[model samples]
Target: MKIMTCPFNGPRPVSEFFYWGEIRPMPDPATCSDESWADYIFNRNGAPGVKQEWWCHIASNTWFIAERNTEKDLVLRTYLFEEEL
Candidate 1:
């Protein structure tokens, strides 16, 4: 079983967190084009690299960011959502 370290709360079971989706460069829907909307909403490339993904701490009801190393099945970094930091 893989372990996930929450940047806010420290180590926890992977199953305790839910994979929300990819962290987008731009999250606004009104400004996005049709193709961009489709890609953001439905398309995802399962490639190996540093990817920004959304993760929700189900038990805590908190949301956070996870920088994932796909090839290694490792989380490079994790952090709480800070609008400015």
Candidate 2:
């Protein structure tokens, strides 16, 4: 079984975590055009590469970011959201 290291809860079975979608920037709603907003909501690059994504621990309700390689489906690192700054 695969293990995912949670920033707060240490290592756990991958089954204990939920895969959230990729992390992407959102444009300012006030200044963004309708087309831009629509594209942002519906479009995805879908390229195979390293990307940041969100994951959550089921029992602890902890949310964190995982830097992963899409091609290998390997999680390179896990960190708290604030630590990304």
Candidate 3:
């Protein structure tokens, strides 16, 4: 029953959003070894904390970032890709 604000569409039901994985920097593939590249593609930091992640409004297919706390399942804020740090 949680409501999430979409940067383009304003407030919407949480059900309308898809939880994409955490936003992390991709290693430089040109210089990265096979193991490192594989790690980058397969590994995830499972630590609990406020994390910036990608979420899409499925109905609109619009993508945005949400700063959410894992422990409480609380979303601190949501913004467009360009609006983030």
Candidate 4:
């Protein structure tokens, strides 16, 4: 079986992690434009490179950031939500 290494934990089954979505253009809903809101919600560009992404640790009940190598199925880095500035 394929396993993934969660930086918060150790190696584990891929099922333990849930892909929340891409992390970008997180705008303030109150002042955001219709076009910007639509783009943020409906558009997605699955580019392969270093990017910030949201992921839920289903097995651990934690929200965190993940630096994913999209083309390699590799998680370059992961940090808890609390770690954010």
On lDDT, the candidate that comes out on top is 2
Ranking by lDDT: 2, 3, 1, 4
Write the residue-wise lDDT of candidate 4 on 1-85 in tens digits: 6566665777678788788877886789899999999988888886677777888768886678888778886778788767877
lDDT by residue for model 2 (1-85), tens: 9889899999999999999889989999899999999999999979999999999999999999999999998989999999878
Task: State, as a TM-score between 0 and 1, how close model 4 is to the true structure.
Answer: 0.78
For model 2, the stretches where C-alpha displacement exceeds 4 angstroms are none
| Cα TM-score of candidate 2 | 0.92
Measured with C-alpha atoms, the lDDT of residue 16 in candidate 1 is 91
Clashing pairs in 2: none
After superposing candidate 1, which stretches have Cα over 4 Å from the reference? Answer: 26-32
Which ranges of candidate 4 are over 4 A from the true structure?
Answer: none
lDDT of each: 0.83, 0.94, 0.93, 0.78
Instruction: Please give each candidate's TM-score.
Output: 0.78, 0.92, 0.91, 0.78
Better of 1 and 2 by lDDT: 2
Task: Please provide, for model 3 over 1-85, each residue's C-alpha lDDT reduced to its tens digit, 9 standing for 90 to 100.
Answer: 8998899999999999999989999999999999999999999999999999999999999999999998899989999998755
Poorest lDDT segment (10 consecutive residues) of candidate 1: 20-29
Model 3 misplaced stretches (Cα beyond 4 Å): none
